[model samples]
Target: MSNEVKSIGIIGLGSMGMGAAKSCINAGLDVYGIDLNEAALATLSDAGAKAVSTNALDFSQQLDAVLVLVVNAKQVNTVLFKTGLAASLKPKTVVMVSATISADDAKQIEQQLNSYDLIMLDAPVSGGAAKAATGDMTIMASGSAEAFSKLKPVLDATAAKVYNIGEQIGLGATVKIIHQLLAGVHIAVGAEAMALAARANIPLDLMYDVVTNAAGNSWMFENRMKHVVDGDYSPKSMVDIFVKDLNLVADTAKDLQFPLQLSSTALNMFISASNAGHGQEDDSAVIKVFDGITLPGVEK
Candidate 1:
């Protein structure tokens, strides 16, 4: 069955997308790296994946599955619909979308793809780039059993844990957005707490050690604070990505007339960080927004 899924394509070649492409190669699948960036294509090619310049690709590759890990729903839509890729795919092809999107949007995408006789899988991933590279990422996924069966090899090639949420097209997206709700808020709180420590003239490393050992510890605090300790906000995941993701969560809640207090607050912090020209910086740099908060890298 793995050999049956000989050709696979990745739409975006950013950190997460690139990692997944490498994971596909590691699984011994024929992986096609698609991106507008020559450098990203080169990097994937260096890792033994076939590099295709999106502008000039041979249509004969006949991919069995294509993973869309682009930044947002807008980019996902552009890649599938506007680029004419979805319509060009043959029937029984599985088009898995891994972008963090609203359930409504995910359902809409599935319906559109169905018109082209393509299977749409709503599969959102977690565990960041490093885990993705090693194919150890968690996937919150929902799709028809037929779609799941046809795309089994593609699923195993990139995920360590693939949660079968439901047969519905958008069920996975619903869970993924809820995850963003917690992730965005947790990172924001970590930034605020660490910023307060800096304002109080506390040693950054010392405070990190204490909190990580004590009850104040959180996964976000432990993971994101390492960037602060090293003074490198080099965009592992950019502030603007969280700005967009949190806003998606807020909008999804708004439509249901549900209140999201912490997620709403965190969205503002990310927005402020973006508006202050830290948008492209790593999300941990959100601490830079607080007045008199010393960011080790920004000054140095």
Candidate 2:
């Protein structure tokens, strides 16, 4: 059978989803967008999406593939099951789940989708909003060969790199969780280092420049700390996001009887930042948890 997906429905028109939707349109695919935000729907409509609505059931029959890019497993379950998306989709339709969720949750979702005769890909994405906008994000995915064959066009449009982990339902989510461990730790430790520099009256910009060019620099430090230096905490990604992701890491590790000291510490840092009312702020605001230092563009 020829497995070709020329039409796709995307749930969640947030930063990542909106970008992927645009990329699909750019790739000349028929795109349907579903989101609660009317403005986002209008924007996608203007971007040449074939349709936009708050409910996928409105256009589910037109979709050859469904991309779920919501925040967590709960939202994914709600959209796919409670909201009637799964029941509405045509049998054998490929569903690519790109949320940051636990491996166990991914497995459960896959089993549920199988009952509907739908193909499930446990796909989690990285590279943030900017890269997503340019169709250069990375996707770690695991699914059956049929699902991979069916989703090829959408995958090519949305991701610059796609790692096929295997034919397992949860391995993609597992890889993404492991990646989040490093990402959360790097951001937390970068905040600590910057906080120490601030305490010593060193110029944060200068510190950023030196460190970014040095061996100690990480992708998280380079990207997130720039938000700190520019004093723009407008939440490219929120503090609570890492709190959730790291908590997943912690929970997964506990299940495996493994100890993740750095990940645990980073999770606490994010928790502290969230508890301090920075939950909605950019994750770089973790630096705000440090006392007695003046942050740029904020009244101390």
- Candidate 2 regions off by >4 Å? none
Candidate 1 wrong stretches, greater than 4 Å: 1-4, 55-57, 295-300
TM-score of 2: 0.96
Residue-level lDDT of model 1, residues 1-300, one tens digit each, is: 342466788889988899888888888888888888999989988999765667413552468888899878888889888878887777778888999999889998998999988888899999988988888889999998877777777788888899999999888998999998888888999999988898899999999999999999889889998898789999888899899899889888987899888899999999999999999998998888898777676682
Question: Per-residue error at 194 for model 1, in Å?
Answer: 1.5
lDDT of 1 at 285: 85
Best-performing candidate as measured by lDDT: 2
Q: What lDDT does the true structure give each of the candidates? A: 0.86, 0.94
Candidate 2 lDDT, tens digit per residue, 33-145?
99999999999999999999998899899999999999999999999999988998999999999999999999999999999999999999999899889999999999999
The true-versus-predicted C-alpha distance at residue 29 of model 1, in Å, is 2.0
